[model samples]
Target: MKKLIIASVIALFILTGCNKDKDILNTLNDYNISQQDKGYHFGDKLNIPQDVLDYAEAISISFGDKETSSLSIDPKFFSLGENDVTFNIKTKSGEVLQQDATINVFAKAKARPIAYEIANQYPHDTNSFTEGFELHGDTVLESVGLDGKSKILKYTLGSRTPILEVPQPSNIFSEGITLLNDKVYQLTYKAKKGFIYDSNFKLIKEFKYPDVIAEGWGMTNDGKNLIVSDGSKNIYFLNPENPSQIVRTIAVASNTEAYDQINELEYHNGSIYANVWQKPIVLQINPANGEVTGILDFSNIAKQNTTNEDDVLNGIAFKGDNMLITGKNWSKIYEVILK
Candidate 1:
């Protein structure tokens, strides 16, 4: 009878402990800060809920192995876009409760809407499924994609024929291209490899993408590091000497929320201009923290070129002081001046 009584009491204690933890979790889960459509921004404070306040003795936040006791959304404490954070709560019961959640941080200012005026037009290859584009001196460098037809080419600004064209292997689907230190860098889609070339377009070497990036979408350079996008909200800065090494990562976001499908990158005048896939819009992002500073709506230009769904605007290049844009299988390229 005594053994039976002891077993009953022990079972009751275990049940009570489980219920306590569940109740505390329920209280913490009830306050969902991430659900707020207009998320927090720089200089904002995450309001602690009354229930959490009552239940916790100490609260701490952790992001990417960095932990802080304060909940301020300072740029030093948090980054733009989605922040996956862990709340380490020391409860009044001397129990530690860890809650993992997403805290979205937006840009401080709304993205300025910029308009464009067509400056000139040039002929482009309708057969080119244009992926990456940029201009160096009087030459326009382009990278086109497809399983059997991926190639990189460079042509004069006003001409349709390429002065230099290099085709990829038949099975390789190439994506973006960039130039740094007079060497050409090109990324491959899904193949997880990148090709480097000498100034004269001779194959120098090949390297693989880091384990974190699954696919390469666009690439450009800031005179030093190579800035790459993987069709996500992230922009990865990599070492030009070693493409597999990640220098840093920034998540692109505006005042309202974070954005994805960042493609066709171009670094010019301290801003990284990017194309949002399938949308006739170009975003000017501040590379310092991935805060979107300006937006250029190219809906009319897209309408002029878009014949079917796949003919979305997907190219960005700078010609002298003006910007040049084209699309997949586009017959014409338009030069524009940003206002």
Candidate 2:
């Protein structure tokens, strides 16, 4: 009887050990670890959870399918925008586990000085407090700002006289304008309303803009969607069919830091170019990641065109292969080929 009892006790111990091992395996299989902040900056030390380390015999980190541990959040990884880092686990026998973990990687701002040459200059209206500018063939469309003076005007390339003019409500302060399909969409500064007009510059509808932005500053369309800035670091993409709905938001950043006061946007050659408010630099930004790929210094243009401190550089438009830029209450419009 004593021998049988001891044998039974030994069998119970073995069964308990097996159950413990099975529980560990079950926990490992179900474990899903993520970065605490949902994003890691460039050069930030990669953090591996202690629990994850204790369970796995070998661990490998990868961006997409390629191992990124060696890159260490370098430029190559950052330039690709947000990335998913997968943690692959292996068991004691080098058997791949069923469960894997993923973390998000974000880029740290990096500055790149872009070069440009003045290809030509054109005549622009001095009375126009240019907030939005766009080119349709040889003609130019502009949205002039200020509470009492707000209006949308279409002008011939070198003429101060407008071909067509549409006035906004005297109380509504107008901001940016963009052309989508056969319609014109315009933003207001603080009213949280946007105006839509036909190709002939006649008001067809007025819709409420999204409240995600504090104030409207600039707007442009990328063939499919409308991109808007609100005098902040954020740029929002909106569906044309549903103007109030935001498709996504991109936070503008340089190599070392994030930037604010992004205004007067223009989409050209697959890049979003914006004027940083009150600054003499135009940022060539990547739409996918909000990375400032290049900085076009407009100090020369600003210095040559400044009538007063209020007349800051503001307008940007694409005309064929050249870019047309102007400012608030300033004289000439510059047509330059970015080199």
How well does each candidate superpose onto the true structure, as a TM-score?
Answer: 0.88, 0.71
Per-residue lDDT for 1-339 in model 2, tens only?
A: 999999999999879755644555455444424342445566765555456567668766666546653525555544323344555566565655533443334445556787778888778888899999999888788999999999999989988899999888899887899999989999999998888899888888888878877888999999999999999878999988888999988877665445778999999999999998988889999999787888889998899888676799999999887888899988999888878
- C-alpha displacement of 273 in model 2, angstroms? 0.3
Number of the predicted model whose TM-score against the real structure is largest: 1
lDDT of each: 0.89, 0.79
- For candidate 1, the lDDT comes to 0.89
Per-model root-mean-square deviation over C-alphas = 2.9, 10.1
Residue pairs in clash, model 2: 109-254, 109-255, 109-256, 110-254, 110-255
| lDDT, candidate 1, 253-327, per-residue tens | 999868888999999999999999989999999999899999999999899989888889999989776889999
- Kindly report which residue stretches of model 2 are placed more than 4 angstroms away from their true locations once superposed: 1-110
Looking at model 2, which ten-residue stretch has the lowest summed lDDT?
A: 28-37
